[model samples]
Target: MEKKLKKLKTDNARKQIKKNQNIFNIWTKLLRISAIWIRFFQWRKWHKDHTYPKPQVGPLMVAEIQQAKERWITITQRQAFPEEINSLRNNQQVVRGPLRTLSPYLDNDLLRVGGRLENSNISANRKHPVILPRQHVVTEMIYREYHQRYMHVGPQGLLAAIREEFWVLRGRDVARATVHNCLKCFRARPSSLQPAMGQLPSARVTPSRAFAQTGVDFAGPLVVKLGLRKSTTTKAYVAVFVCLATKAIHLEAVSALSTAAFMAALKRFMSRRGKPSHIWSDNGTNFVGARKELECCFKKQLTGRTVPEELVEEGVQWVFTPPSAPHFGGIWEAAVKSFKHHFVRVAGAAILNFEELSTLLAQIEACLNSRPMTALSSDPADLQALTPGHFLIGTPVLMPPEADYSEMPDNRLKRWELVQKITQMFWKRWRLEYLSSLQSKAKWLNPTANVKIGTLAVLKEDNVPPLQWKMVRIIEIHPGKDGIVRVVTVRTASGQQLKRPTVKICPLPMGKEE
Candidate 1:
């Protein structure tokens, strides 16, 4: 009997909830049904709201959709749209047309209007005001205003323009393009040219002789390790070397990159694989800052080209890449990639400081030299992997280098025709074949072509026609549509008003950029 009474109370509570739901509002009308009935009868309410009076269904349909468009600051679109709406109504224009939705206020109005019309059973997708998207019109308006006011753009100029002038902020080129296309700028964009077939990049420099030349690249200033026993933050760096002919690599890690570590790396390089004839490193602090600064005294000047002097003493020629041309330092850069891929997989993070770091370099170098590589040798058809040591094994020490303090003996060099002997000794055999077949036809070492106004260009200061050069300032900046740029002096000390001369820029036509 008690269980029956408790069940009765629970049923009463459920019935109370059902009765309360009848008062809930749905759409324009109040619902008056039990919760269970509401669920069961929802389809009837929807049909009553959505379906037109049965007789009205046979008439041809007429409806409008509204979308938002940008408006001028001077006009309130609320006024403009209503006036347009009244005109449409009075004219009895049967054609459904787009409504211009402007501003968020306008767009919100249009959205609400669309929602209302949708609620009233009209199609929301067709013939709406404000067809131009908020993002699109704003972007167009801002850019159009800017291009009219400021004709040219710089890196800083562009940044400032985007912030204050262009409507879309920061690196939003896609929106800019959209706006650009919709506005006056649509007529200004140049036609794109047909893409030419890409030529194969030349194989990395193949020196005339083996072990005669080597290239260098920096790999890391890896995250400092505190200690194997106690972690403390201290730094270390890695340097890499690659042979020109065989493509084998050498890697070394140094503690603090002082003159001391630099020298130690050189010594280790020489100890393992004999000395190279030529060395190529970028203008890095480690390679350039090894010497003390020169102080002018009474009569004479101190001369120390630090790393270059060291290379000269070691009988190794030194060549540096033209500034801004990392492509020329291809070998070591490739080796650097391999090092990163290998180091991450193998290096232990617990080790820190120079001592431990330098100790690990040998193991890293071994891994780099041992990896199988598929880059074609001088011969396009041949492929091989000769690890650093493998290339040296059983090779005749033809001259049995004396490792003397002074230069080679005159007789031995004379007998061997040193230059020819070195060339034949080290060049990949396939290269000799290629050279034998190569033409001596004329070509420019630094190719260039005819210059035009607004032709994108990079200036060359030190890279003139001579064998060696320097680049200090941008000698030419292409000015679009503003034809000839004539210049007399780059140094403002000389004068600023002088005409600027323009030079042909990069991606020079095959034979032209020389």
Candidate 2:
């Protein structure tokens, strides 16, 4: 009985949802039809009441075309449409009679072609088209008003919308030109070009031990059940440590984003991989605090006081890139991206407990470390491409082989010498294959002329109107070591200063006098 009741409830819920969707579809269709009808009526009223001048087609013809349209309308109304309208609409009405040429398209009180009424002689797609006068500011005003009505849709959309009720000469050309000069459209579009690529840093090219020069970053605020009870929960953050030279990764799960949490994560990393010489990361408050703590510890030890052995011996240096600069830490940022990619799939919709989440992160770290650094060899006879594990463990982590080393007569020689030789060989291959591969710049192509100070620009925002764009002037330019300008500081008319990337700004094309 209970099972039947539950099934009935589910069925009723689905039926209700379907009924609501059908109603919504019907209402939407009615609204669209009504809007189109209202737009047609407005166009008809506008055409009947407004008088416009002739458009300039060049010299040889110098009279108003609006007067010609008026004359043609009067002739058609009085049942006097000439057999040839070339002299009535296309030509100035210098002559009028039954002998005048009538327009080819004429039907009972309406001009009809292709079963459609010809309200005006201007044809964007018709021959013997009634030419709209250039002085017809009302026609252009109608076009502009319609363009704004559609939220600045492009020329093609505007042409389609305007063609439904009335016709105008060179309508497509006018729409195209109007859309081209639209300030709103220009502010919303993405930048067409970018500055040149910056040079690679020395750490990227230099050979070093795995994790000796590391980049650290945080990835998440994932919620995990804390205690045995499902109701108890806490937030967890993942700290990612990526080796700059080899691209190997280490992940630590911390309880919070704080100085204590980061310090603990750093200690865990150091414990397994050994202390890094230099750590590169963004200027997060926790990271800054950790650096201060490390300095204090070093000072205490220098004063002859006992400190943690790792703190005294490590002598780690924390290097912070500028604030809001994620690209500067792209190495570790990419590593974080990789971790999240695998994590989402593996933990899909599961509210894991803390221990479970931690274990999964460790497994993800192992999988990333084992991935091939380059494409796999197609030939069965050739060895596979080298990975970060090859530098760290002298073998792939995916299928770690059993220990096999030659026994030496002396205890110190065999184990130590073989490990050193294997690491040296890996570094040699890394320099030849991996380091050389980083030479090309995949993005930020050839540089253009630098943006000069005092230049006017609009700060781009998501889903904002063009008129609402903040007017700003470039006050400072920040060029990377490669001498390519990617970021700049701008001051608004309100005296507010903001630092924005070049991608987020659209500089106005200025005239020499302006």
Model 1 / residue 88 / CA error / Å: 34
Please write out the lDDT profile of model 1 over residues 177-237, one tens digit for every residue.
5343431232222221122122211323344333556777777778666666666776677
TM accuracy, model 2: 0.64
Clashes of 1: 36
For 42-124, candidate 2 gives per-residue lDDT tens digits of 45646766553322333212233333333333333333334334443554442444222322343332332232334556553
Q: Which candidate ranks first by lDDT, i.e. highest?
A: 2
True-structure lDDT of candidate 2: 0.70
Q: Candidate 2: misplaced stretches above 4 Å?
A: 1-153, 157-181, 190-193, 283-285, 288-315, 321-325, 403-415, 460-471, 492-496, 509-514
Per-model lDDT = 0.44, 0.70
In angstroms, the error of model 1 at 333 is 1.4
State how far residue 322 of model 1 sits from its true place (Å). Answer: 2.7
